[model samples]
Target: MDLVTFQNTILPIKDKLFRFALRIVGNPMEAEDVVQEVFIKMWNNRYNMAEIKNHEAWCMSVTRNLSIDKVRSKFRRETGIPEGTDWRDEGLSPHKSAELTDAVSRVRQLMETLPESQRRVMELRDIEEMSYQEIADLLELTMEQVKVYLHRARKTIRQQLIQSESYGLQ
Candidate 1:
């Protein structure tokens, strides 16, 4: 792709790429590095860029692979604990704020417990709000497989959430 095309198309998805990388690596700085590496790789391969049919999916797939590599190189251990959620929305009552925070944290923990493939599909479909076709293209899965994975992931999350609520963990 030309420089103008690259800037207009690839640059606009930087945050999306960062978020995808962060979802895998769980560290902001590492995610940023991964995004930079992805851009560098894309630039280096610019000659073949025109052959790509879906640049966004291509970029996301690269980000996912690189982030997974970074995590694997570190022995799959988390780099650090995430910062605590800030319950600073002035519109919310203190009790409501606490409830929202707790709910979000609980769901995040539940998501982390999922298998890698399911978690990835869930993140792309639900968190990223990507369509099944886009997710399938990125993950190298069929469209039907993406739908199945999403359904199973959501079901697992729902069941776990119900159990947690029944146990007063929520």
Candidate 2:
């Protein structure tokens, strides 16, 4: 794609890519860095861009991989487990912002408990609002497989939340 075409097409995806990176790396600054790096890499490899049938999927894959690498590198230099490890244990109060934040935290925790494939499917689908075809292409799964995993992940989270509610945690 030409520079102007690429800018018009890809610039709109920056927020989504940043959010995806943030979800993976759990750090805003690092996520921004990853998005910038991915965009730079995309620009440098612009010649091969035509070979990519799905540019958004390609970008998401790049962002996810880079975020994972950053997380691993940071872990290697850390002395202990990161904060928010047990973030799911925190429940949402009825207050608006706290409730939303708690719900996000709970979902993140439940996501962490899932198999990597399921978690990724859930993140890309529910969190990032990606289409099934897009998610399938990004994760290299069949569309049906993506739907199945996403369904299962949602079911699991719903059950967990229901159980928590029954226990009067909220």
- The best candidate in terms of TM-score: 1
Q: How many residue pairs clash in each candidate?
A: 0, 0
Q: List the global CA lDDT of all models.
A: 0.85, 0.82
lDDT of 1 by residue, 87-158 (tens): 224335788767777788678778888888888999998778998888888899999988888888899999
lDDT of 2 by residue, 13-77 (tens): 99899888877787777788999999999999999899988888788899989999998999898
Q: Can you give the lDDT of residue 132 in candidate 1?
A: 88
Assess candidate 2 and give its lDDT. 0.82
| Model 2 pairs in collision | none
Model 1 steric clash pairs: none
Over 4 Å off in model 1, which ranges? Answer: 76-100
